[model samples]
Target: MNDEVTRYIDGAAPWQTAVCEKLRLMVHETVPEVEEQLQYGKPHFLQNGDHAAVIAVARNKVSFMVFNATEIPVVKGFVRALGKGDRKCVDIAEGQEVDYAALADILRKTTIAP
Candidate 1:
């Protein structure tokens, strides 16, 4: 993990930490080349010269925030997790189960696009 991401995760609550760790690892697995950084005090995953995505710990959920969620399929499946998003974010509760393979597929399809 990058120092920025480590710092961001360290600042979160225990549940947030767990969720963030899972998201972080999932993002890395899906896009190993995306640079991890701290943006707006949250962990951001960026593809070179492309729009970046952010993940943050919310009061009741962890959000995987994407710039264009309508363009991604996973956001639709996560109807329960979906919230009012300026871009489009997949907010997942700590206790809720996440489909890792599916999440990876969404991330891959969304982030790799030009």
Candidate 2:
């Protein structure tokens, strides 16, 4: 990770930390080949020469933005189940638990696809 990426994660708001960390770990574990980088002022996972996803700290919730949401339909329901926008974000509140297994599955699919 570069300085910008470090700063991005380090400077996240309180509510974003847990979700960012979990998503980051999930990406690293499932898509070891994808590079971790900071782009558009957010921590992103890149694969196949494109960004697979971005994790950001938001005012109301922590969000994981899938680069191509429509390509991965499984995430729609997953995100909805998390009380966030389906096919867009899997938001969780502070101190809230997330479905890590589902997250890992989403990351895996996001990275392996075209």
Candidate 3:
């Protein structure tokens, strides 16, 4: 993890920090080849030198943005962000239990090299 990214996450609220860490750990644990870095002032995960995912902390929730995630996964306890694009996000609010296993599966599929 980059120092800047670490600081960015550490500066968030406690609930956001916890959710951010969960997604960060999921990326590293499930896709060891992915690189961690700061992009557009947020922590981004890269795979094959392409943007794979991003961690965005908001006032009410932390967003796990999955790039090229055209197909939504059936992850429990995760709500898809409302938007349009080849991207989608799972908004995790305070006290929400993160389903790491399901998130790992989604990460694997979304980050796979075509």
lDDT of 1 by residue, 44-82 (tens): 888985555678887887888765455554435573224
All-Cα superposition RMSD per candidate: 3.2, 4.1, 2.4
lDDT of each: 0.73, 0.69, 0.81
TM-score of each: 0.79, 0.76, 0.86
How well is each residue in 1-114 modelled by candidate 3, as lDDT tens digits? 788889999999987888888789888988898898998989999988898889999899888888777776534556464456467678888888778797787777787844
Give me the displacement of residue 31 in model 1, in angstroms.
Answer: 0.7
Off by over 4 Å in 3: 73-84
Residues 1-114 of candidate 2: C-alpha lDDT, one tens digit per residue: 557766776687756765677688788777777788777777877887787777878777777766555555544444642224234567777777788887777766656743
Ranking by TM-score: 3, 1, 2
Clash total of candidate 3: 0
- Which regions of candidate 2 are displaced past 4 Å? 74-87
Worst 10 residues of 1 by lDDT: 79-88
Pairs of residues clashing in candidate 3:
none
What is the descending lDDT order? Answer: 3, 1, 2
lDDT head-to-head 1 vs 3, winner: 3
